[model samples]
Target: MDPVIVVGAGPVGLTLSLALAAQGVPSVLLDEGPGTEEPRPARTVVLREDSADLMGRLGCRELDRVGLRWSGWRSIRRKQLVRNVPLSGGGGAEDDTALTGLLPAPLHVPQHELSAALRAAVDKAPLVQRVPLSRIDTLEQDPDGITVHTREPGSTWWRGSYLVGCDGARSTVRKLLDIRFPGRTAVERHAVAALRAELPWPDEAVLHRQPPWRTGGAEVSARPLPNGVWRLDWLLPPRGELVTPEALITRIRDTLAGWCGETPAYELLDTGVHTLHHRLARRWRKQRAFLAGDAAHLLGAVGTQGLDEGIRDAENLAWKLAHVWHHGPAEHLLDSYQAERRAAVAARLRAADQSLPILRGGGGLRTLVPGAARGHDTLLSDGHLGCGALGAPPSYSHSPLAPPHTEAHAAVGTPPGAPVADVTVTAPDGTTTRLRERLGQGHPLVVLVAPGTGVWDRRHWQTAGVMPRLTDAVAALPGSTELLVTESYPGASAHTVLLVRPDGHLVAAFGGVRPAELFTAARTALGGAPHEAREPVEPGDGESGGDGDGPDTGRGQGSRARVHADGSAGLH
Candidate 1:
């Protein structure tokens, strides 16, 4: 088995490698790191709630330790408050209801800090072979694998079953594939700074939008970092404005002063200027090589979704590869990654288009006044500081992977393709636990047994009884796990069986059914091989079944590729 080759060492590449490693897949991580000490602006990235959950699931627990959690951003016009879009719906304070929910609140972290955490995870995982200072020279794909040629002091070649390009906006992989990235660019440049200062204002983040009345004004936003510094990004005047160090300093001071009555003395840590754009790749995949992160799309600063969306692309692609390798599922399974993620990013781009002008021009300042009407709602809906824009989880109802809702499984309100809400489940022994704690992770189809289903005794199944009929039904499929619990969520009926994919989305659910029939239905919904449904076994007559097999830990078992870290191919 060949390793999956990952290009680029940014957060997305590091994240993709680590996610695959956790699932027992190995990868070769290639990056041309610090070729030169070119100065770069201090940029901060915000992770939506779902993005935070993806990080937590991938074992990047250092985020909360090194990142600041903010409820939302305060939108202000000149010196007056226009509106406050609270992402969590509570005041600026941390909401306990949100903190205790399935996902954590949004986070603000310096780009470097986020990269460092992901790199640390990569360093710790043995399955991830990190080849720093290596750059991709060329790539060619054969029918079964891809050959990647890299250049450093000494050029070398490597092989992989799949190659994922997580390189930045000017992605070499995308260029090699000749996939056009089409979109509009903003001629205006933006200045971003990382600075430290003491302020007498609420800890929440703030975005100051200059009303259209101020023709030559720039929009500025500042957010607190866990490291005691603040990240400030403001639009710079068009090219001929003649920007100077003093002018930049004055701009920062003025922006800060407007938010916090007075600007105290401050130390500038870093600063840089760059242009932003709104672009998407014509295609994210070409044969065996694929694109993720900034390589796939660039939403620019208008929408702080570039990093989060890239992280999501990695999350969506990793599990499918794992499933294919581990279960020998149809290769078509891999196609869903593009189908689902591309649509999601398209929606995000549309939302960004509607809100970018509002952010830069304050086009909706009047509508944000107290008791404003719904006409301006789109302007404040899904931008950098908008409530609806955070994490914008996608619904794959139109995805081929989602089974259509049918009369057979109507009671479960969770429509096909919608993300499954984490529900608290009560055990027969009174032990309580959340579904997400077990549903996600491992690549497998989860069998959730709802309570009151006369199909089996709740206590008996919980303690450890197996229904032989259920075992025989899924025996042919590999890389699958099962869970038994009394229904705690409202949707589960007396006897319910929910077949969920490894990503935690419901594939199908059946109520008041027998084990064989439920298992057969689940297989069919999953598009697996056909299986004949059987009747429920008589008491003690069939093979006993407990929680189904745990995640596959053995090497080279699934249809997915197995990577070997032989170091036969070397890099600096």
Candidate 2:
């Protein structure tokens, strides 16, 4: 099988390659620059709870240990505390009850650190073939495969089943595909500097805004990074003003003094000026070539939406690509990538656009009267601030991959397109575990049985006349599937069976045992044609059935599921 070609070796591309490798798919990673050991200049990047969870699952465990976790941001206007926006909609990070059963808190890690972690994981992945200093000079795609030629003379063209462009803002892949990026670049630029200083509030970000009468209309935000490093970003004056090193230092000192009551001694680590853009590609896909990360969308630097969104883009596309590669040609599965992600990126861009004015020090009446900006505040509260707080990620309810929602499934609270909550569940052996621990781990498709108030016995399921059919239906599917029988699923009714996709979105949710419906949904989701089922087998009847205690590691104890490092399952 041809390897999937990944352009750009940044966090997003590396993440995509790792995610695919987890699904037992091989990918060739390409980057134009030579690999560097020295960490890039510090830049603030907050990983949302989901992104953090994904990174952990993909083997970037060092992030949680090294990255600082923040609960929220404190907005101060002219030395007066305005609002303390919580990250998880609770009091603060210390409030465990408010965060109970939720994904981990948002992490404040520099982009370099994140890239380093992901790159490390990629280096360890045998399925990934990393090619450094290889620039794509041309891209050509045929009906079956994609070919990318590097700029290096005498170099052979790289071949892959599909190509994804994770290259940054000025993407050569998007340009080669002739996809139009439509959006305006903000005239207002911001100076971001990384400093080594001790901050009083080390766990929370602080945003300070001063009226034009004081500090020359300053708007700055300081977020604590790992160690004593703090990332400071402040809006730059319109073009005419010459910004010298001395002037920048004076501004930084004044801002720190205003926040800390005194200018604490600090060493400037790095500084750069960045122009924000709100651009998004008109198309995310053309044939076997696709766009992700900054290649696909470019939101203003208001909340670090681009980074998190790009990571999500990688996750969303990885599983589908794996499914299609392992199973067969599933056009709908691949097409849904753009359908779902494009809409999500568009929404985030809109939210970023709404929040840009305030971050740019144009809050106006909204700043003075907080109630006047209730709508904008709603966006912030809804996890639009910094990294998406513990709030819900984008929903794909409208996507073609999502089954049509009905009132019953809606009442269950696990909607067809909504992300499955990482609720804790009890195994039949009384072992407790989070739902996410098993859902998308080694299987692209998972059948979660929530026998609410019902016994965990297979006899009960057989008596209800759903076990045999369910088992047979799943057995007939193209790829590996996991059947998890838990004591109860929160927010779902008795005998509830949830068919989940690899990205944690529900393909379908049944309130009660409906084997035929589940079978149809599974086929539709996998983009497989109707196939005859083998003879019905009860639990423990064959190698397919489990020991009736919990989720059965299908086939055998040695068989790999969806995202295993062994690459035993789903690798064509």
Candidate 3:
């Protein structure tokens, strides 16, 4: 089997590799070293709810079993506890409450912990081969496939069909492709320090933002980590002097010193000086090569959105690789990688670029008046904390991968960071369960929580309201299914049904249960045509009784594919 070479054993590469492996696709993964698990930088990364299912599917145990979740984050001032801004939604779409329930609180884990989890998960994937201490010296791609040459400080030879660049901001692959990276660097350097401490803060994540006293503007946000530790990050003025580990630590100690009278002992875990750079590669793909995560885009650290965005990139690209390698042409899909992602990065950087000034210290949540609307609340948005802007849904706007839409307003709500809410349901046993748990990864899913009455026949599901192309796709599915019941959200009048993809974001939705509407939705949910208005499956049988994925699913033998270390390529 020809292997796809994945550069960087970090989250993005490992994740895409795992997705491919899960589906029997294989590939090889290369990284500079085991990559230290030192938990160094001391940065806290919040994994958006949307990326959770994808990561869990990749087999990260922290995502599956041990990660910490915060229902939402609370904002605070020097003295007062401001508003508690909800992070993830309450499970907005009405699908199986099972999957929706999983959309509960957002997960907050350290970058290292996350790395450790990805490392473990990838090790178990049969199709993934982990090659540590190895680096790619050069890459050359042609009509047939790609040839990757890898070496360590010392080394040998290896070949592959494709390469996914997950290297950091200074990406060698991006350079190899000659993709230009255009963006600016923040003039104000930041001091980020992680130290063990006991602060008077909530167990949930806290961002105590403040305006820079001298600058009359910039702001700083301090986050608490898992152990009895905390991270203090603040913007320094253009003329601000340089600071070492001790000096930065002392400054933090003195600043928060008065607040916490009995200063808890703080041992500096790690400290670093980094200037935030906002840039996106000129392109994301060239021939058989692709870039994801930090390798593709870099945004100032305003909302801790970098990692989650990368994880989403992997999931999106993984399936595209799977489908093309297993069934169609590869070139047809590569263009979409840049078309879809470049726009996303541009938008994120724009927002980050705008918000950076507020950090140098004036407006924004950092300047919210204490007694004033501590938080300006509205029914439509979540935090408005610049997060909503970055959490902006992903778009396949210019890509052929997404079917063309005729609607005047092309709705794009299913991308990586869109937030969702939760709902209740009448389970198979006539009991209630949540939607989150039901959001199993890998399966193209249709979640129908809206209550509909007419016996949904195939035609009812077809022309009633389904979008032409989407309906066709769903209808052709092997056993595309739906979950039906009453209200997904309490007190909400109209029943909203959303067609969700394998990951937990909405693909299509309609608020009413109009007969014609329900049919269109079912067809849309199924991806189209056959009008599969099949009777709903009984409780506990989420699995469609295909040739057999049941009590006896594997059949006479397990179907398998020959895969390399990086999860790419499949040989039947």
For lDDT, the strongest prediction is 2
The best candidate in terms of TM-score: 2
Span of ten consecutive residues with least summed lDDT in model 2: 552-561
Candidates' C-alpha lDDT: 0.63, 0.68, 0.55
Residues 415-499, candidate 3, lDDT per residue (tens digit)?
3123234445433233445544444433344333333312333233322232222223333333323242333443232333444
lDDT winner between candidates 2 and 3: 2
Segments of candidate 1 deviating more than 4 angstroms: 34-41, 85-104, 187-189, 211-218, 236-242, 357-378, 385-391, 411-414, 425-434, 445-478, 484-487, 490-496, 512-572
Using TM-score as the measure, what is the rank order of every candidate, best first? 2, 1, 3
Clashes of 3: 51
Tell me how candidate 2 scores on lDDT.
0.68
Candidate 1 residue pairs in backbone clash:
325-558, 325-559, 325-560, 326-558, 451-487, 452-494, 453-494, 453-495, 466-545
Mind sharing the TM-score for model 2?
0.83
Q: Taking the candidates one at a time, how many backbone clashes does each contain?
A: 9, 3, 51
- Against the hidden reference, what TM-scores do the models get? 0.79, 0.83, 0.72
How would you encode candidate 2's per-residue C-alpha lDDT over 394-423 as one tens digit per residue?
888788765444443424566677777665
Task: Judge candidate 3 against the unseen true structure and give its global Cα lDDT, from 0 to 1.
Answer: 0.55
Off by over 4 Å in 3: 63-67, 77-82, 86-104, 152-154, 211-218, 358-386, 392-400, 404-443, 450-475, 478-498, 509-572
